[model samples]
Target: MKAMVYRGPYKVRVEEKDMPAIEHPNDAIVKVQRAAICGSDLHLYHGMMPGTRVGMTFGHEFIGVVEQVGPSVQNLKPGDRVMVPFNVYCGSCYFCARGLYSNCHNVNPNATAVGGIYGYSHTCGGYDGGQAEFVRVPFADVGPSIIPDGIDDDDALLMTDALATGYFGAQLGDIVEGDTVAVFGAGPVGLFAAKSAWLMGAGRVIVIDHLEYRLEKARSFAHAETVNFAEHDDVVVHMKKTTDYLGADVAIDAVGAEADGNFLQHVTGAKLKLQGGSPVALNWAIDSVRKGGTISVMGAYGPIFSAVKFGDAVNKGLTLRMNQCPVKRQWPRLFEHIRNGYLKPSDIITHRIPLEHIAEGYHIFSAKLDNCIKPVIVPNAG
Candidate 1:
């Protein structure tokens, strides 16, 4: 098997590796068909994620066919095409019972957090990821979802992470009919956030980003109104104007590190004197949200701390929800949506390359060049 092995910061190699085999009674071995790079993967690539040591397989979003399954896996079998959930969770945990699969204690028992992510790091359970020709999926009966007929691998790949995250974000933000929702960032998660907002009945969906190409794609595919953050020095003003000066009912932070700390500062009315360039969209979303509005943050974060405006958040009485998506809970609903054609998440796919050229795709996507929005890697391409 060949895989994109992470060597160190800003380095990856397409090298031969041993094929994975089923290790547990609940395990299944998937032949990787299509996998995509995620923004979170980039965080690891740039060494922003702590404890991500070298030589780990690096991918979390993918769809594949089940080449083999354990005897205990009754729901799924050989030849079943499935989408892999990024998080590895056992379905019987306390948190999983409460529909909080992301916080399942059974997966990441030793860590401060509860979730375990593939290809993330040793801290996230050190599970080998789906970036190779074959991946061993634990908890196969509970985790993998068989793709319905007529769905291609490219379209089903997002069910693993981005699309589900976006759906979870929108659901957490309480997007409803006649509500106005503002999504920060136009990256893959942000794009899906906008689409989820629209699908959940948001009357107006505004997507903010620096890239014109992404914003344009958001407008066309997500049915979102666009705000080019680079064009407007006062993003808050633009957001306010768009939302009738009352602020949006719900603001989702899909740009995590890019917007997290700044949003905290803005909502609390603190001084914006931070030296580093945090994603301004966070501040804009906080300032652009109405009093008592909801904010859902699904972006990845680092250990570095930034000042937040606790006072303003208190005064405004806003509700802040933050976490990784509980993919196990959301996967069923998302899959149904995809199967029914109500969600076309694959519209975000901007590039498709063979697994051999995955490094090149990474280069283009990491640099944000050539209108590259989301790139998929086909492992079996010959």
Candidate 2:
């Protein structure tokens, strides 16, 4: 099997590797069909995530055909086509029973905050991801669902992570009818978040980014207003002014870790690794929302200190909600939306690369070249 192997920071290449076999009674081996390079993957690629070791494959969003399943895996068979959520967890845990699958206590031995995630790092349970021809899925019966007949494979792939996380972000906002919502970042998650806000009855949606191409995508695909943070002297002030000086009813920070607005913050957080992640976008969210409004955080950040405005949030009585998304929890409603033509997750895909050229795919996406919004990997391309 060929898998993308992480070399040091800013380096990755395809290399032949041993195929994964079922190691647990509840495990399954999946032959990956379509896998996506998520925005969060860049964190591991750039050495922003600690414990991302060399020789580990990095990918979480994938749909595949089951090659083999253990005897205990009753819901899935050898021939089933399924979309596996990014989370790896046991079904009967206390957190899983409460629909907090991302925080399942039985999976990760390293930490209690985040459950096992495919290919994230040792901090995330050291589970290898699906960025290759085959991957091992633990607790297969609980995490994977057969792709329905009408859902496109690409759409199903996105549902594994990006699409589901975006919708979950919007749900955390608790948007009331006629409320104005502001979303920071225009990546796949942010674009989907902006689009999902409209479905939740937001009267207006605005997407903020520094890239013109992504802002253009947000305007056309999400049908939301756009703001280039680079063009403004103070983006939070601009957000406040746009929302009639009281600030938006809700604000979402979809840019995590690598947010680039303040020079010092990016240097200390992203370059020097002094802080867990840059809090520029999150601070902007806190400042851009109204005093009593809600702020939803869907961005990926490391488990460390960040210079967020916690005091200000308390002063303003803001409701701060954040967590790693419980991907399977959003599937039922998302299936209906995709079938009714209300949402098309595949429309955000801008590049598709063969598994052989995954290094180049990561480069293009990391560099933001070719106006790339999303890149899909084809493990068995002809």
Candidate 3:
């Protein structure tokens, strides 16, 4: 099997690796058909994630065909086409019982805060991801769901992470019918969050980003207003003025870890690795929302210190709710949205690359070249 193996920072290449086999009774071996390189994958690519070791695969958003399944995997079988959520968990765990699948206590011996994630790193659980011809899926009965007959594979793939997280962000916002929603970052999650806000009855939606292409996508794909923070002297002020000076009713930080804006924060957090992740976007979210409003954070950050405006959030009585999304929890409603043509997750896809060319795919996405918004990997490209 050929897999994308992490070398060092800023380095990755396709290499032949041994095919994975079922290792647990609830395990399944999936032949990856479609997989995506998520925005959060860049954090691991750039060495922003702790314990992202060399030779480890790095992909989480994938839909595949089951090649084999263990005896205990009753819900899935050979030849089933499935979309596996990023979270790997046991169905009966305490956290899983409460539908907190992302924080399942039975997986990831190395951490207590998060459940096992496919190919994220040792920090979550050292489970290999599906960026290859085949991947090993644990707890297969609980996490992998068959892709419904009418759903597109690409749509199912995005549902594994980006779209689901975005919907979760909007749900956390608790948006009132006429509330104005401000979303920071025009990445996939941000774009989806902006789009989902409208579904939740938001009166207005604004997407913030430094890139013109992404903001353009937000306008067309998400049907939201756009703001380029690079053009504004202060984005927080711009958000406030746009919302009639009281600030937006809700603000969401979808850009995590590698946010740019403050020179020192990016340097210390992203470059020097001194802080967990740059809090520029998050701080901007805190400052951009109205008092007593809600702020939803779906961005990925390291498990360390960040210079967020904790005191200010308290002063303003803001409700901050965030977690690694419980993806399967959002599936039922998301499926209905997709089926009704209210949302098309595949609309955000900009590039599709063969597994052999994934290193180039990562480079183009990281450099923001070719108007790249979302890139998918074809493991068995013809």
Candidate 1 local Cα displacement, residue 186, angstroms: 0.8
lDDT for model 2, on a 0 to 1 scale?
Answer: 0.92
Clashing pairs in 1: 258-279, 264-309, 268-312
Worst 10 residues of 1 by lDDT: 268-277
Worst 10 residues of 3 by lDDT: 261-270
Model 2: residues with Cα > 4 Å off, grouped in runs: 261-264, 304-306
What is the RMSD of candidate 1? 4.2
- Residue 210 CA displacement from its true place in model 3, Å: 1.0
Tens-place lDDT per residue, model 2, 30-131, is: 999999899999988888888889999989999999999998999999889999999998989999999999999999999979999998988999999999
Q: Tens digit of lDDT per residue, candidate 3, span 10-81?
A: 999999999999898989999999999999999999888888899999999999999999988899989999
lDDT of 1 by residue, 57-159 (tens): 9898887888998889998989988988898889888777887777778877558675788778877888888888999899898888888777677767887
Question: What are the clashing pairs of model 2?
Answer: none
C-alpha displacement of 326 in model 2, angstroms?
0.3
Tell me the spans in candidate 3 whose CA falls farther than 4 Å from its real position. Answer: 261-263, 304-306
Q: How many times do residue backbones clash in model 1?
A: 3
